[model samples]
Target chain A: MKNVFIFTSMLLISLNSYAAPPTFEILIKDHLFYPDELIIPANTKVKLLVKNQDATPEEFESYELNREKVIPGNTQAIIFIGPLSPGVYPFFGEFFPKTAQGKIIAEEEGK
Target chain B: MLLNSVILVLREVLEAAMVVSLFMAFTTVSQQSRYFLLKAIFLGLVAGGFYAYFLPEISNWLEGIGQEITNTMIHLGIFLLLTGFLWLISSNIVLPNRLVKAVMMGAIILAISRESAEIMLYISGFRSDHFLMQSVLSGSLIGLGIGVSCGIFLYHLMIALKPAAATKFICVLVVIVGGSMMSQATQFLIQADWLTSTEPVWDSSHIISEHSLPGQLLYALMAYEATPTWSQIVVYLTSLALMILVIISARFLQGQPKYD
Candidate 1:
């Protein structure tokens, strides 16, 4: 019984060690994007907040990640990114692509 | 750039086609048919020009009202116009059978007017020394040509088919096109700061970029955007609601007594 209890405790500890969430933020202003490049851990869940400070509406989208959302002017929106593999993911503003663009760099955590 | 321009022109042409088809299907009269269509196309171009010329000025002037107001109103206007279009489509008055010529003319006028096409021209990066006049004339001519061609085709098709069946098909087509336009207009309002919201309800930022071809097409046709503000949501919902109500009432009235 003692050995079994020790084994169960070790399993629980190991699971908890690998399960931390990542947090990030983005801002949209003057039809442009701030922090045009974003880096995060691969295969880890991430919470992203996008704030639009411009007078016009902007869209935050990424074909690689398969996500799209509208960020209204003077507002903020929250989004989640996947348990994705490590790589470079690009994003941009839908209305003004030439001027508004960004990327996400997914890398292995603690590597 | 060429392909993009073609696509844009085609999309606008399709819209013009819808308007023309609805008009042609409704009328069997031959008197002044071509004249009516031409006038409609002319008016649409003028309206488009007006919008293009004045939107920026209006937007800039509205700076003091706050972005929220500007966004909401723009969105609201688009929403209202789309809803009005939808209402026209769904009502029992039978689009092709009712004032088809008049509606076509109205839509064309709206399309080419300084308010609509002009804004599109500017946004698409077309500029001239005689900015307003040139834009209006160009947009009107384009819309007119499309409207005339579509009108001619639909008129012939109706002549070949039974009136009852033709009317039904035209009604369905109008609803589809009008609904799509409403969606697109709603998106435009949101992007223009005519609809202000607190936050985007869903953020798919990690996935697709909404500015791509598919995204832009959706934006132009159905007004779908990756991010939408609170005021945009409100305008979309309210406009949809109003459209539905108006359609239902119009249909009911059509079914009731006619003075004539």
Candidate 2:
């Protein structure tokens, strides 16, 4: 009975860990991305929760990521990025490109 | 800021303008009332306003994939309607004028709604900013002017051509335009993870950067992409092939004109 309980707990924990992708929160205020540089684990799909606090609409666009999303003012959007190789992927707010710039650096685990 | 507004608005406006131009030429050739186009434009604007207003809620749908899903639907809807219109024209079925017009108008409405919703959101975003409002509005007007002028120019050019020539030109243009819509829809699906993505077949940014004016115009007219994935190319080619088949069948098959 003690062995079964321990195994069951370990299985559940592992399942939970494998089930969800890492999530990163980004804030868009005054047409700029907070934490202009984001680092994430390489070769893993991740979710970006982008909250736009401004009163205007902005489009999160990246040529490298091939992602484009329009996030309205005071709204949040979820963008899923790739299980990519280690590299830097730059992104920007298409509507306000001058100010809203950022990059995501994917690094190998434990490095 | 002014330049960005102009380019952004121009990009959206040119897309809708191109479609409208084709329909305008068609209506004139068919001697339909101009009021029909006006009514469609008005309805599209109203619908777009509603779409923009409900955007936040819409964005939250489909497990946070709402925006992509909705955009994909809109793009696909336009492509299908355009295809239907082409089928009607090519099938030797003399459908009622109303039916043909309805299909064309449906495509127009969807196209305009998608473009206008983005424009409305963009313009509204600047409404509260007093300092930038003047520049943005001015830029928008300039973009709108240029876009409409281009449409008018295209319409007149089509009408000025020989009737047979015009029809052929229009058919080819329709095929390309519909293919563009299909490619765009595929991109949205890829973004939503509904379609698989692969590495781009080629990179053309060095030849014609997407940021350039000619590139933007080509994008609006032909769905040009700097780095289109393999899936995108396949879908685009398939759309083109389908359209060519329709055109060839219409010209050669020449079945009995059912309506006549």
Candidate 3:
């Protein structure tokens, strides 16, 4: 029974292991998000790679998308967002909310 | 504008200050021991700076799971320390006094390192030459001042309570705080897809969202989740129950002449 449990756990873990989702990168410079606008495909789970190029950290946050994480100065972080109907997802750098802002435009394929 | 900034920083720093202050009273209530604490805090601050600097680089390891792993490890470390201290106190072990002090001190320092990193990140955002920078500085100072004052108040209040009562209060508070760390660690693991989480148990955000001031305060004090997943709920309840049991046992230990 214990052997079965261990095998099942390993199998489940492997299934979720690092399948590289469609990825997009957004850079943080001078406390502002570069390309302030990002476009992604709708109805598919995707990874959003945020690289903070500034000498300070910035927290990438979005209430609409319900995601938040801090990227330290000169560091990069990843956030994953889901399969959904086409829509706009707005995100901002929490540390410098006044300036660091952006949006994700998820649209139909080939649109 | 300044007031808002102050409040924001205060909300962020409050948890760290309270954890440190709790230890201040717990380890040794003597006035002179404060300098000893100051030394530990200074060391923690320096370590926090290093953490902020290297956080990004560290996150780059382990196939992008490094960030989650590092954060979860720190939180787990803190949770274990507090739990161990509680166990020692309850087990009626006339352990070396230095052991208790060391655990409390290490817990406070580690907690400060993680919490202060956020504040450092926030402050780094406003280093511009504009006038806004000046106000932010003042606001951050005020926020820090207020947060520290609250921690001091809690410490004094803890000391004023009857011995048993103080023990109960601190035990409950620390356990909740430690459980929060566990919850947060679970969250990072889930985010990294290392752990499976069931559906969110409830959504009380309409009544009081985690984004609000009071909500944030509760989050810092206790891992108050407006929308907690089933796993988080399970972990919290289990941890809380165990701590209560430990506290009861510790109370029994207190009656022995060895404790006095």
Candidate 4:
């Protein structure tokens, strides 16, 4: 019974770890990304929590990252990106492309 | 600011316009009353406005994956309805008017809802920027004019062809458009982590940048991706094959004398 309990506990722990991904937050104010440039570990999937502070909606679009979502005013959006190779991926707001621009840099671990 | 608005609005409006034109061509070829198509356009625009209005709450749904899921559903809805429409026509059976109208409306509504929602959202952004409002509104008007003109041009071109040829042409366009929807749906699934992402099968961005005007038009018409992943390609081709299969099978089932 003790061995069974240990085995079940180990399985649950492994599943929990796999289920939760690392999360990063980005703020959209005045139609621009707060961290205009962000660096993340290469080849690891991550979540982006984007909060829009402006009184209007902005679409978070990245052709390189293959992600697009509309973050309505005063609301937030969650976007998942990468398991990508080491490189730079550029993104911009579709609504305010000129002012809202950013990039993500993926690098190898310990670099 | 004006040019930006033109491009942005143009891209969305062009897509909606293309689908609407295709349906218009289909109805013209069949000699069906166009009231259904016109009704669909009006209904689609209204529903789209509502969709944009509720977007905030919608975005927060399903653990913040709501947008992806909703768009995916819309994409798939279009694909399925289009398939049904193609199947009914390809069989050469006397199509039920009500059934045809339902499929047409359903597909148009889904497509417009998705595209117009984006346009409405973008336009809503300029509400607070009073200085940019004039340029944005004017640019949007120009974009709307161009997109609608192109749609009209396409519809007239299709009608100018012989009836049989026109039907064949519309069939080909339907397959391509349906394939695009399937490809886009796969992309949404990948973004939502419902499907695994893979390296792109090829990079054609060097040949045709997706940001360019020509690229935008092609993408709007066919969902052209300069760099497409293996999964996206697979889904696209599978959709094309499925659409073709329906046409072929229906012909076989009806034992049509010969291909058009």
The top-ranked prediction according to TM-score is 4
| Residue pairs that clash (backbone atoms under 3 angstroms), model 2 | none
- The count of residue-pair clashes in candidate 2 stands at 0
Candidates in order, TM-scores: namely 0.48, 0.88, 0.81, 0.95
TM-score of the A-chain for all models: 0.78, 0.84, 0.81, 0.87
Give one digit per residue, the lDDT tens place, for model 4 in B196-218.
87777787888887877777878
The number of the candidate with the highest DockQ is: 4
Which of 3 and 4 is ahead in lDDT?
Answer: 4
For each candidate, report its DockQ versus the true two-chain complex.
Answer: 0.04, 0.47, 0.32, 0.72
- Per-residue lDDT over B103-202 for candidate 1, one digit per residue giving the tens place of the 0 to 100 score: 5555545443423442254234423335644544465556546545755776677656676566555545444444444444544443332432234556
DockQ of 2: 0.47
Model 1 chain B weakest 10-residue run by lDDT: B63-72
Residue B140, candidate 3: alpha-carbon lDDT: 88
Residue lDDT tens for model 3, B184-209: 77766766657653445676878887
Task: Write one digit per residue (lDDT tens) for candidate 4, span A11-75.
Answer: 99999898767888889998789899989888888888899998888999987777788888899
Question: Of the candidates shown, which would achieve the greatest lDDT relative to the real structure?
Answer: 4
Q: What is the lDDT of residue A97 in candidate 1?
A: 64
Candidate 4's C-alpha runs over 4 A off are A1-13, B94-96, B257-260
Residue pairs of candidate 4 with colliding backbone atoms: none
Greater DockQ among 1 and 2 belongs to: 2
